[model samples]
Target: MPSKTSIFLTGATGAVLTRLLNHPSSNTFDITVLVRNADKANILRTKFGIKTVVGTHQELDKVESLAEGAHVVINLAEADNVPFMKAILSGLRKRQAKLGDPPLLIHTSGTGLLADDARGEYITDVIYDDLNVEQYKSIPDTAVHRNVDLLVINADIEGYARTYIIPPSTIYGIAKHALVDAGVSNPHSIQIPVIIEASLARKHAGVVGKGKSFWPDVHIDDIADLYVVLYDTIVANPENVGHGWEGLFFGENGEHSWYQISKAIGEAMVTLGICTGPEPTPFTKEETEKYFGSEQWGWYSSILPREPGACLGMEADVHH
Candidate 1:
């Protein structure tokens, strides 16, 4: 019998990673995860029966060691870390030299790279197409996650690894998996939880400015499935999929304005007796900074106009 494909995974406790582990296809691969917490690593080991390496992304040598041993590397750790990316690529480069063949890398990026500075005041009409290689290559270097993204692209260009990038939009919905059900993994996502927490804090749902700026969104399940689909394709025919700039794939179902999201949150808050009414108010700058933090202000204020182009060929199961 053929041996199981060895895979190295990061961000294993995340919603997407948890869901990916729950997929049936995952059982066919020899999966290993790098976890910072030794206790969480033990839980993942006991629950999923996969190899667990207890180390943080900051440990470049350990990261390189793991990458060198794996047939494929799926990174969801941090999208903006250049040093971490360099470490992973270094290991993969060594693996290619030893095996005389390129390994596969599935990287997780974000739609924020395409976000426009509308500041929740206006909607920008510039939509980025993920399948258009030239368009993706044209994105300015100053974008949020562009530096690390360029590194991955350059690695692919150098022919050491077959790279595929999935840039997801605002992901929503609770994730269901053993780790999540066991309370070891977070079921909620980044953006939605911030909004929910702010609503609870102020006793009312609110939005940044006029909340006219919009962003594309996807259900957690849908985005996770996309990862699995890409993996399966790599397992079957890695050469068929696009790589480098051509590999940019946007994971989004539909777009939603911040006002609409706040309105929904308001209605939910009203039903739960957390707020007085089901109408959202615009938050002031002070409230925005206090509730969501100054760093995350762009998330609530910018317009991320992106549409899935390459992965659209497979037809994403939209749960929006």
Candidate 2:
């Protein structure tokens, strides 16, 4: 019988990772998760039969210790948490040095790194493809989500770990994971949920500027499938696995404009009697920040133009 792969996971409570943990194939792995609260972790532990370590990103030592023993370390936490990443990499490095076998590190990033400050008023033709080496390298360091991704890629290049970066576009749709089977409904994604909240608060659905900005979108289930495929591919042929920045992956099914999104929200609100009309309202940048807060202002307001040619490549590979 084949031995079970030991997988160490962080951000197990998150939407994408939650779906991953509940995947039927995940049962083949001996999984351990690092969660902030033991009580909160119990649900997944019971439903998925995975072990848990109680800790947060702030507890670097504990995180490193947990990561050191795994064949795969999957990080779905904050993309910009450099200190936490460094700690995980350090632990993986120590293990690699001792065993002479590098473990796979699957890290989450987002297409938001390629976002432009359009404030939903305009669209650009500049699109990035992961398969295009020159275009991928052309991404500036100043990009919103670039720093942490660079750190992980550089670590892989330095032989600390075999790292893969999954940069998903805006994710939508309800999640169906082990927790759901155990009677827990996963929270909605940030964009639509915040828009709904703002609409309810202000008595109308609103969009930033002209709301012309566009972003790629994918279903939560599709995103989960990508994770499973990538994990299996890496474990099966670590020798042929892509290295460093070359391991970047993206997931996008289709693209939508913010105007269309807001219009749908407005129409829904009107149908539900939450609003008087279906006409979408426009909010200035200041108004957007006021409603969604400064931290998420860009997420709801900025234009993130991404091409899914690379994602399509992966989809074809997985399906065929």
* Top model number, lDDT: 1
Local accuracy by lDDT, each model: 0.75, 0.70
User: Model 1: per-residue lDDT, tens digit, 1-320?
Assistant: 13777889888776656656666766667888999999888888897787999999899999999999888899976788889999999999999999978888999887777766565677765667776677788889997678888999999999999898998877878887767877668787667666778778889987766677777788988888888888878777867888888887788888777778888999999999887898888776677667655524534332222222111001112221
Stretches of candidate 2 exceeding 4 Å from the true structure:
14-28, 183-187, 295-320
TM-score of each: 0.88, 0.87
Q: What tens-digit string does per-residue lDDT give for candidate 2 at 108-180?
A: 8877666666766677667677776667778899865688888898888898689998877767887755566
The list of candidate 1 runs beyond 4 A from truth reads 14-28, 295-320
After TM-score superposition, the amount by which residue 162's alpha carbon in candidate 2 deviates from its true location, in angstroms, is 0.8
* Candidate 2 RMSD to the correct structure: 5.1
Candidate 1 residue 162 C-alpha distance from true site, Å: 0.9
Among all windows of 10 consecutive residues in model 1, the one with the lowest summed lDDT is 308-317
Best by TM-score: 1
